[model samples]
Target: MLFAHDTEVSLRAAVALVNSASEPETMRTTADLDAFFAEHGYTGRHTGGADELAEVRRLRPRLRTLLTSDRDTAAELVNDLLRDAGALPRLVRHGDVDWHVHAVDDDAPLAERIAVETAMAMIDVIRSDEMSRLDVCSDETCDGVVLDLSRNRSKRFCSPACGNRNAVAAYRARRR
Candidate 1:
């Protein structure tokens, strides 16, 4: 793996969270947030409600900006997130997961935990000079973030659907 399991998980979660704000907006309600948290295996004090959902949604744009930023700019943004969240990294093991860093309290706000985790993951990305792994979708019609974690780092589009659409278009053009 390019990074630790938790780091990769957090990075992928950040990408999904950012892309959730794309057209057709998938995270529109508390149920959506609940599903998101569950799917990402997020553990903490989740005071689920409309306000919490909105706060999480508000973080999307900031994360998107960070993903698309240059190395230096991304580092600055990561620092800002850590500082604003008052992150204090600590290693802990829970459930089936091994020891991994958690920078915020388990009782911290969901948004703060997400932000801090993403920032902590970005620390791995930046220190490893792997910021190139973060990218925007290559599809012209999509603004989704792409986390290129593949072995060859050949992942271009955000989803298989986007890749399939482009592939089919190219095949049709070739046939014509």
Candidate 2:
């Protein structure tokens, strides 16, 4: 794998979080915010509260900006994330896992943890020249973002189901 297992997980989680912000003008709500974080398995003891939920909602657009940013823009944002929250690079192992870098501080707010973790993962991607692998979906009708990890670097859809569904539709249209 290009990164450690947890790093990969964090990157994908970032993509999912970004896509959740791409909703139309009318449908985003607090419940929608809760559902987005919940689906992504974001766990925090006190993050179940409303203010925390609101912070997650606020982060959505910022994450989305990262998805479409140029390398310079993304680097700036990554730096801001790290600097704003004082991310420290510490190697840590907990819960039976092997040692890995923890950019997050234990006392940091949930959003700060998320920002630092995501920024640290982006640091890895940038150093490896793999930042280009991060992408938004190519489905003309959907704005979902995705992390492309294919061996051939050819992924264009956020989900396989969306890829197949759209492909079949295109095929039928050509046949008709």
Q: In terms of lDDT, which candidate is strongest?
A: 1
Name every residue pair that clashes in candidate 1.
none
- TM-score for candidate 1, please give it: 0.98
Measured against the true structure, the TM-scores of the candidates, in listed sequence, are 0.98, 0.85
lDDT, each prediction = 0.94, 0.74
Residue 126 displacement in candidate 2 (angstroms): 0.9
lDDT of 2 by residue, 59-146 (tens): 7778777756777788899998888887779987766567777776666676777777788878777777787787777888778877
RMSD of each: 0.7, 2.9
Model 2 worst lDDT run, 10 consecutive residues: 21-30
On a 0 to 100 scale, what is the lDDT of residue 27 in model 2? 19
